[model samples]
Target: MSLPDELYNAKFAEYIDSMKIMYLVDDRFKMICDDYCISKVNAEKFRQKIERDFQHQLKHENLSKELEEEILIYIMKNI
Candidate 1:
């Protein structure tokens, strides 16, 4: 399966190949990637609303980072 576009632009893009393999073989990993993609998309929206609602923007930023870390750790363990 093709990954969400956000995955390619993320900081952990370097490990994308591993992520893809995991995504294809592991249902949990695929769910994680889907969640990560949703979190990232929401974070991007929040970033645009930074001036209107800084708190939510900050919250999403932190959540996005956490999800990114989770993906990285998952990939590492499976790789």
Candidate 2:
């Protein structure tokens, strides 16, 4: 995902938004966000990123139901 200065700057916001949404739906997301001092005003920018990511991953990953559940657990643990 590396790029030239302007492109990187542009995409950085998207990636941050993605991470913010990842935290948003997560059960522990609020606690983690507060720990990092992220404000709701900024966090709201991530509202759709998680659903987008889920759709993308679901379309591309093609995992079995069990594997999908496991992957979700792994993500929850690491985040």
Candidate 3:
């Protein structure tokens, strides 16, 4: 699977080494990376909106956080 750029972004970039390892061996890890990227993009879009949708922005932010936690946990366990 192609790694998502979000995985290399500042937020999770430190885990790139571990993530790349898991990403190559586990499909689920790749899915989580994909989800994180999507949620991040959505959150940014909401942030940039002139008429902001705070609810949606918060939702995406929360999802991103949860997914980030999961990724961290997975990396730690598998590393």
TM-score: which candidate is best?
1
The C-alpha TM-scores of every prediction are 0.56, 0.25, 0.53
TM-score of 2: 0.25
The sequence of per-residue lDDT tens digits that candidate 3 reaches over residues 1-79 is 6577777877767888888889888989888878988998998887778346666788899999999999999999999
Better of 1 and 3 by TM-score: 1
Best by lDDT: 1
Clash pairs (backbone) in predicted model 3: none
Residue 51 lDDT in model 3? Answer: 46
Per-candidate clashes, comma-separated: 0, 0, 0
lDDT of 2 at 19: 56
lDDT of 2 by residue, 1-79 (tens): 2222222244356676565565566647545555544444345557667778889898777667768899999999999
lDDT of the candidates, in the order given: 0.87, 0.59, 0.84
Error of 1 at 38 (Å): 0.4
Candidate 1 local lDDT, 1-79, one digit each (tens): 7877878875877898898888889999899989998998999887778766877788899999999999999999999
Candidates, ranked, lDDT: 1, 3, 2
Quote the RMSD, in angstroms, for model 3. 22.9
